[model samples]
Target chain A: MSGLLAVESAGALTTVQDRGRAGLAHLGVPRAGPLDRPAATLANRLVGNDPAAALLEVTWGGLALTSDTGVWIAVTGAPTPVEVAGAGRGSGRAEWLPAGGRLRLGTPVTGVRSYVAVAGGIDVEPVLGSRSTDTLAWVGPPRVQDGALLPVGAPHAPPAPLDTPRPPRPGALRVVPGPRADWFADGALDRLCAASYVVGEESNRVGLRLDGDPPERVRAEELPSEGMVLGAVQVPPGGQPVVLLADHPPTGGYPVLAVVHQDDLWQCAQLRPGDPVGFARLRGA
Target chain B: MDVLDLRAFGPAAVLAEVADSAAARSLAAYARAARVDAEEVVPGARTVLFDGVRDVDGLARRLADWTPDGGPERGPLVEVPVVYDGADLHDVAARWGTDVDGVVARHGEIEFVSAFCGFAPGFAYLAGLPEEHAVPRLDTPRGRVPAGSVGLAGSWCGVYPTASPGGWRLLGRTELTLWDPARYDPALLAPGTRVRFVPV
Candidate 1:
């Protein structure tokens, strides 16, 4: 189905996102894709949308929308209450929303981000080959606003059969020692793995700022700005480590102590402020 | 030919350490020109980061086999007109041990290279200032630096592409549009572009 999805309420923060703009970091452009990759991928699969098709990355839920045509929709990540025409519908599976049906979402129960996928993806104009919004650089399509009419693309294949969602893995996040690990004090890596850090309130798409014992530094000289990467555990002079995310700056001056394993990075997207987290050294990294 | 010290950045990338910023720029330029099998070839102050390489070991071996001989290709020259009335112009003059006019003349004479882009979109780290003329950053960063404000920190010069907090010592303001998303190439100063500051 292809039509328009009118936004009734855009919630706290909502933006159109897809696979994101890669190969542009050299120009200082951030790769602004969905923070929770697996969730977004699942949402698209459930609705039969192309893997790279754009979707809504709804933060803290509360998004309300109405469609002009019947369409298959699916919600994934941080299980939240979904309603269509004032009737309750289950998340993590495709559900048909009739024409003129009002669809609404409640606050998520656990995670901080939620993904909403329509049979046809959100067809916003792509910048640098993606529809994802880079909050840091203000690149790509504008943020989804209330009363905005978002065009939906033509649907492809039929929705996938409903499957049980995989349970979240439990344990400390795995990390590999960064190149600048020598900039920190002796045993700094051990200290970093030992301490439990709480997510700071200042956290956003750019990074997850942690509040805990700052890793001690041995070097006093300032580090010249260097290229940064996704999941870099950069520690500022203040000592708190900020785990770089999808929208992090292309370069930074802080010393990176470790890089979180790519597979474990999605967990950071769902972590709420004040949530306790810990890290462990990845063996044979 | 100097060898690069390659270090593991993460699972998908490798950090190649170079001798200095000049070598870093050269390495990045060579990698791009050679069409290195990587998603991004990024240049920093003293490192070139190759990210999204499927086979890190193979890429490292290939990189080791090559040498960064010639410097980056001299890109098209872009002349930027400036109004030399920045907030820190006097401070910079005092530090350079010259009058305001002398500072302007010295800055205008050098042809700077766009070393790399960082800090903000379209903001290029122009390298040309001699080591003796290096300037220190402001003790405290300004809350908002106007767009098109040309500033110097240490041995590098840059134009603020957008209004944001910054600590670089302002030398002047340029009327040129540094960044525009609608343009075919958003950044006015891509890496390797040669630039000259002309006093208008």
Candidate 2:
């Protein structure tokens, strides 16, 4: 099944994404990928597509699309209200979209972004070897807009076999101490783990800004600009922590108190504004 | 050549603090030449961060034994034609106790090597200026500096790849695209590439 998917309405921010463009940080290009990796992978798998195939990343839902031909699709990430031609439907499973069928998604009840995957994936022109869009740097194809037509790739593999439900997302993210942890007053990491932080409204793919007690700094001297890694819990002069994400700058000058483990980054992606966040310290460097 | 210092950046990255920007660039060059298999090797002012390494121990051993081969090779020169009509052109000239033409001449005389890229994609931190030539950033950053606006901050001169909020003192503007994803070389000023600013 292959044809065009017409974008009726793209709510908030919607962009095509894949596994991301890697090894380009030296050029200061960020690795822009889906926030929820497992969700994206599962969506692709359910539709019998390559795990890294580009898919529609719908932020705050409200995405409506109509296919020109029959197609298989699966919606993953924060469970949300879904409908096919005004008929209520469920996600986490593949469903056939008949020709001219309209698929609509409502705002997620708990999460921020949702993934929509078709059998052959979103066949958009790639930039820097990845279809993912870097919102921070304005790289790759422009963000999805209303009335845009998305060409569907040619389907190759059979539909993925049905599998058990995925594990629930955890509230406490695991993290390890950062190299600049010493720059902060002792027990800063402990305070960060013990206290709860609410996600700031300014949060986006670039980073999740946290609003809570500011960690006091022991040294007032400035740290030279250095390479930043994904999931780095960097503390700016304001003392609040900002967890770097997919669109974070390749380098920064702030002191990083800790870095969340890669496995726990999905939780960060699903986090909604005003949602509480807690950290669990991990042993070993 | 000494092993300098190697420290863990995060679980997935290791940062090597070299003696200077030259050493930092050389270390990044060595990593590229040796095929270290890291996802990204980012060189900074005086540090090189190796991210997404599968074999940390093996990489550490190789870096410890590695020596820069008489400094990294200077890649092809990228000439940037600039119109010296920046907002701070007169201010920078006054700070240096020189006239507008003198400031432009001094800036155009030196050949800068791209030491690192940061802040924004293709925004290379070109290093070559002497201490006296270095100038502080603007007291307040502009909301949106136009793309290709050449600027100087501290000891580094860079051209903004895209329109963005910046604190650097604007010195001029260029027509050349600093970053183009569709091009074979996306970043016009990749690290180690020599740069010469031509006044038009």
Candidate 3:
């Protein structure tokens, strides 16, 4: 049966997200999706939702909701204290929430984001074939707000067995030289790999502003704006590198020195402000 | 036909570096016409990015073999009615060594082509202004450039799809709705669409 979720507290920042709109960059649309793809996918799987189903992305946890129907739900991503009907429940497992049961998530202790997946997924109207909220372009569904009534779709299949293990900790991000690597000085990529950078406070879904020794540029002339891709490490005139994310603008003028491997980008979603990050060059790149 | 420098952009995409924005547009058109196996074929100032490729090697080989004869095929013409009363009209006149009337006449005469879209949704970078008449951006960007404000920066012409902070030299304004998400084709001036700024 279908259900409804009453938002009691929207937490720090919560938004609906799905796979996101693809192939629309020509019109300047950003591909806004869950930053932690694997975690979101696992949450969907645990709740028996389709991979393309829309779910909630909670930033720094603290989301509180009340379900109007008994449904299966799962929480993944950053480890947080999950409680249902005042009973503490473990994170990363499917849990039953009876009708009128209240679900609350405490602040995450380690990661920056958490994914909450219900059995049938969030039933918001899709825009451009996605439910993800693009902070850069402000596309897709609106951000979750307190006192909002969210419609839940009918259950598709029974909830998966509650035995999925949490994903292992990510290692150093792997990188390869980008198309505009020549714009930077010699050994710039090596220098980028050598230095340890911290996530800047201004970081958002658009990009991860990194604080570290800026990479020196060989070319002083303004580079014409070019198509930017996800995971691109674009170095601005200030020398600091900003790793473009899912909501990054379609094109940019700065030179890109390196690109983080797609498989490793999920680690960026969990990194909190001041989290130290390191990079490693791909073998033979 | 022009040879393009191809570079690998991450594992799933390829960036074809071209000489100029026109070449980038042409290459993007060529890729789309050839049905290149990619999720998105985006044209930029001097590059065409083929993203989400299933077979990167095969797509790269196909791109290498392409020899475009000329510019991209032009789309339908879009006539924009401009008021020619922007705040920077006198400033642009001083830069062009012409009077305000002269500037308006010259701008209305030229036929511009939508080269690509960026900076924001439905914001097309319209090209076609001659190199010598290129205009410089303002020393300081305005805090807010109203939606439909037609402006120029370095030879590239654009109309703000929505109210935003901009650095382009404002030439005039239009009433056309540049972006509407509910519309079938949200961007009124998509890439390759021919544009003409008719003085109102």
Q: Rate the local accuracy (lDDT) of all candidates.
A: 0.90, 0.90, 0.90
- lDDT tens per residue, model 1, A1-285: 379999999999999999999988888899889998988999999999888989999999999999998788999998899998889998899989889999899999888899999998999889878899999988999999999999999997898847666677756889999989999999999999999999999999999999999999999788888888999999998998999999999989998999999888889899999999999999986
How far out, in Å, is residue A66 in model 2? 0.2
The runs of at least 3 residues in candidate 1 whose Cα sits more than 4 Å from the true structure, single-residue gaps closed, are B70-73
**lDDT per residue (tens digit) for residues B113-137 in model 2:** 9999998889999999887889999
The top-ranked prediction according to DockQ is 2
DockQ of candidate 2, scored on C-alphas against the true complex (2 decimals): 0.84
How far residue B52's Cα lies from its native spot in candidate 1, in Å, is 0.3
For candidate 1 chain B, the 10 contiguous residues with the lowest summed lDDT are B65-74
Report the C-alpha displacement of residue A160, candidate 2, in angstroms.
2.2
Candidate 2 per-residue lDDT over residues A194-275, each given as its tens digit = 9898999999999999999998899898887789999999999888799999999998999889999988888878898899
lDDT of 3 at A226: 81
DockQ of 3: 0.82
Chain A only: TM-score per candidate: 0.98, 0.97, 0.97
**In candidate 1, how many Å is residue B39 off?**
0.3
Candidates 1 and 3, the one with greater DockQ: 3
Q: What is the DockQ (computed on Cα atoms) for candidate 1?
A: 0.78
